[model samples]
Target: MATATIPGPRMPRAMQTLGWTSRPLPFVERAHAAFGDVFRIKIGRDTFVVLADPADVKQVFTGDPAVYHAGEANIILLPFLGHKSVLLLDDAAHLSQRKLLLPPFHGGKMRRHVGLMREIAEREIAGWPTGVPFAVQPRMQALTLEVIMRIVFGVDEGDPRLARLRTRLTHFLETTATPREMRRLLVNGPIRAERRRIFASLLDPVDAVIAEVIADHRRRDDLADRDDVLSMLLLARHDDGSPMDDAELRDELVTLLVAGHETTATALAWAVERLTRHRAALERLTEEARAGGEEYVDAVIRETLRLRPVLPFVGRRLTQPQTIGGIAMPAGTKVAPSIHLVHRRGDLYPEPMAFRPERWLGVRTNPYTFLPFGGGVRRCLGASFAETELRAVLGVLVSQVRLAPSQPANEHVGRRVITLVPDRGGEVVATRVAPDVAMPSAA
Candidate 1:
């Protein structure tokens, strides 16, 4: 006989609607506090189990891919990323697609491109004016976009259309992901109409650029020169020896562009904020970077991901009946493992909220506990690439520039789209740190 399902409190319908279409972190935090590790919340007639327990997160993430596929979790991204993108694949298809794209993000390949990342960062940082109050989010976004365009698409940094595409896409993402904006879109039909108009305005340039790349690849007689991710995908063959169609190629390109750039930008921006707030940590990072190479800087980056993960929660649907945390879960149920809550568990992390890079220096936490990039078969494809870019950009920034928060410490920053972003854009007063002088230790 099956175990009886554990009944949990449900979020009120109005609150559920508000939470679903608006920022839901406060409500989620309250539920976790009330119900312990696991709780249920109703969103638009569907019951989603929000789980923060590390054990339960491990079970759902590492047990069986079929039982908890990400396809159902990523429905919101489908209209933007499309079906063929690796973000939406599952089972065998997921595995195959991941294999095809794995080379560019592999350790060796990423190491080879570290110079490119550093070069881009140096170029961008050189342009910042002294003692200027600049929005770190937009500048970081632009820098990451340039890195992605060069490495992933092999597009020149001087391309005009690329700049326009980035602006349009950024605007679209900011508007669509805002809690208040999403609520309007969900409740008012006309909001979607306006969104469609904006989306159409943006897609034209993106399509033209991608189409040109596809045509160029098709016309090339010798494929040896094609070495970027785009080129690799162009040359890759399926089991039946069939090449990817233009439509498939377009989806993959867009996926890499959007997913590749946005999350890293968010992570970098948060790292800047954290480093600014903690003076000792920032100074230590700079000293370590100067003395050695990227090890300490890497730890700082990893710890940042642990604390304020770019994507706070990832969803998976239960395709088979399973029991987690002694509660029975049926098929078609959505289970969310929150990185925000999991990384802050006192048992797992002694000072869960403290910004300490030393924790990552010698100790290695379980993969499931430190899952900013997730784990198992469905782990993020660009994980290695992201780390490389982050290390390079952060190392450069911390060593060359000092960042001070423009806003007060008590200000409430919130989530936007697939990332944790500040509500007013993370404003920072940046000044170029002299190369010879040491930065004061973070207090």
Candidate 2:
């Protein structure tokens, strides 16, 4: 069979690289407009065949795990997340790590962290300056970072260790997410020696703190009684009955930090950004938040994620030749389901760019059509947990105060490494604060 030639922009690779790194949404929109549902585009050394059709997305998501190498497609993350990180693992290694990490984020186990999430949200919400504009993304980052530290690292409030690690990690993420650094990342890829050394300088101290926390947890007698993820992981045994070693534990912990922290924060920031611009939706969500029901709040989150998915695409590099949507792809081709484009397709969503939570009410969205988190076996293990945290945080936020856009126009999307975020950091003003909201005790 002849492989169909996938059409794309005939522009130089340098222009494609710039567009991808700095302004992905426009880049993708232009490509999809010019080349239809499937097209090829190069970023750094890899050529991604971007697919916006749900059927093609379903194929990549449900494709044979051996032939669809998600980890290889995500190799750029390895320098920060480490080789043993599940995000960087494939096949049996990926399955094993995923199994060990699953129990901690299981439904009942995850709900245990909600009260803490709300408390953190309340603490942060209380500090926002009233009647003044501020970037909510940084505040959201602080809130989510604290949640990850407390929940995943088992370091609770007032822990000096938490304070130190938080400072270091925030700076590290900020530095890496800057445009200059991101451009460098796009140019050099993940394994260049100087880049690795620079990353080592940032990651080493964070790793040191993680190592300390791991050792301290091992020596504690209350390990079995604790509900935090690190404690649960410590108690977990592999299928072979061996406990995970220090390196493995460290890698997984960092993976959770990288995977959970900014991604959830960016989602929350976008939620605030979207709600502030749409008055009726904001009013309805505020009422829902105060009255205490999951239905509408859940829809609001779904809609926010749909319109502003953190990562624009989820990729799987072909390890063996395969056909998708009638096009024969050779091995080494990265098949990326364009999450941003799929979510915006008018066929799948009417008035696709509008923020409408009502669209999700009483609606069962097809998983492939509405995957803010990537689909199938490689789907984010923390999906439920992230959603749970979003609900808790947003609930506390709306109940405590009302937000309005700082500027008349909406903020443009910005690239923070691999995640899409509000360019102006979701600038919003606290227009009103509900008086004397009752504080729930910590769980």
The candidate that wins on TM-score is: 2
User: Which pairs clash inside model 1?
Assistant: 279-441, 279-442, 280-441, 280-442, 280-443
Per-residue lDDT over 1-443 for candidate 2, one digit per residue giving the tens place of the 0 to 100 score:
22236888888889999998788899999999999998999886668899999999999888889999998777777778887899988999999999999999887777788888888888888888889899999999999998999998999777789888888888878787777866666677777834456577777888898899999899999988898999999999999999999999999998999899999999999999999999998888777776677798899999999999999999898899998988888887888999999999999899999999999999997889999999888999999999999999888888778788999798999887778999999998885564665323333
Report clash pairs, candidate 2.
none
lDDT of 1 at 44: 70
lDDT score, candidate 2, position 263: 98
Give the TM-score comparing model 2 with the true structure, all chains together: 0.95
Clashes per prediction?
5, 0
Candidate 1 lDDT over 1-443, as tens digits, reads: 12224444564767775865466666667677877887777767566787888888889877889888886576555556666778778888877777777776777777767777888888788787678677677788888888877778765557665666566556655565667755554454433444464345545656776687677667776655744677777788877888888878887777887787778988888888888888898988878776646678878988989987888778888888888888877777788888878888899889888988878987766877888987777778899899988988887787678888886683245666667776556678888877676333211
Q: Which candidate is the best by lDDT?
A: 2
Candidate 1 lDDT (Cα, 0 to 1): 0.75
